[model samples]
Target: MAVPVVTGRHARLVRVTHALTTLCFLALVITGAEIIISHPRFYWGEVGNVNTPSLFDIPIPASRPWVNTGYGFVMPDQNGWSRSLHFQMAWLLVFTAFIYGTWGLRTGHFQRIASYYNTAQRRTYLLVIFALMPFMIWTGLAMSPAIVGTFPFLVTLLGGHQSARTLHFFTTLALLLFIAGHVVMVIRTGFRSNVRAITVGGDTQA
Candidate 1:
């Protein structure tokens, strides 16, 4: 007799990581948007600043008056605290991912996902884990003053600090969209049942 396979459930460890990722990502997005308000201009190449010719700029007023937002007023500057929170949350997210990725590989959890997810879900997971995250980390570090100071090549590889910042903005947008779509998926698939299945590990009701 063949062994039976159980789907519609998640391991305890998986659920824990999922929850942590959600919290960390939420903080990151909030802080990221707050940081963006300080300066909305974007540029390319080895250098860019308030005086440099911007490739483009958001029409809204900047939180910092030093930034030429073409508006007379400035928004309240939240850049200081937001940047601190963003940096801290980003590391938490990275650590959680590292643990999950290592465990998934060691236990063949990635391969086992085929039993639970359809092609689209698998593709989304793979793309997020393998591509978007690494790219985001790279670009994020590229924008950091200390990181770039120590590893100048990091920024050089991405072209410049401003380039990294631009890419990071777009990447954040992509992550937000992914989260939105994921919520829609959960709702469509049966919100309460799916939530229970993931949290408590059991087959969900249709």
Candidate 2:
């Protein structure tokens, strides 16, 4: 009997991981937005506050009463719930990433990189996978008191806690742009087929 060959679809683990990651990321984006609105200022160095000079402002009213956004009234503070949800989703994303990474490494799945991505997609994605994502994760961890307390070097390397926070915001923006471009590419290539491939997959010969 001839062994069946799977074609067109990504690995089952990859597809499942991709789906989970997407959901987690979408949730994170929503929660992150709310968190930012609580204080839309970016800062630098180890310490910063409303009193200190902000590196930049988002040009929108803050959601917190203490932020002093120069608006007539403060928006309701969704920070508590949003931050809690954001942390939960971020950890879930990290878990998925760990599984996907380990599986890929163990199976040498990354050896098939060229087959899964085009030249442009490969380049852009490799940058995200290897560089930007790591940077974002590092900065995020650096900003956490618990994380910094244990791994002081993480914060030191980044120069300060506030620096990490500022950098994380920019990293999020870069990821958003990448996500938008990825969506556009999928639509241009064939939205339905692409979705099918990522989910149930495309045609396969057995």
Which candidate comes out best when scored by TM-score? 2
Error of 2 at 69 (Å): 2.2
Return the lDDT, model 2, position 156. 91
Please report, as a residue range, the 10-residue window in candidate 1 with the lowest summed lDDT.
1-10
Q: For residues 1-206, could you state the per-residue lDDT of candidate 2 as single tens digits?
A: 12223555667787899999899989988988899998889898998889999999988898877888788578778889998998898899889989987887677566556456678887887788778878878988998999899999999988799999988889999999999998998788778887887888674221
Per-residue alpha-carbon lDDT of candidate 1 for residues 65-122, written as tens digits (9 for 90 to 100): 7987778998998999998999899899999999988878777788777556789988
Q: Assess each prediction's global lDDT (C-alpha) against the native.
A: 0.83, 0.83
Provide the global lDDT of candidate 2 against the true structure.
Answer: 0.83
Q: Which regions in candidate 1 have their CA more than 4 angstroms from the true location?
A: 1-5
Clashes of 2: 0
RMSD of each: 3.0, 3.2
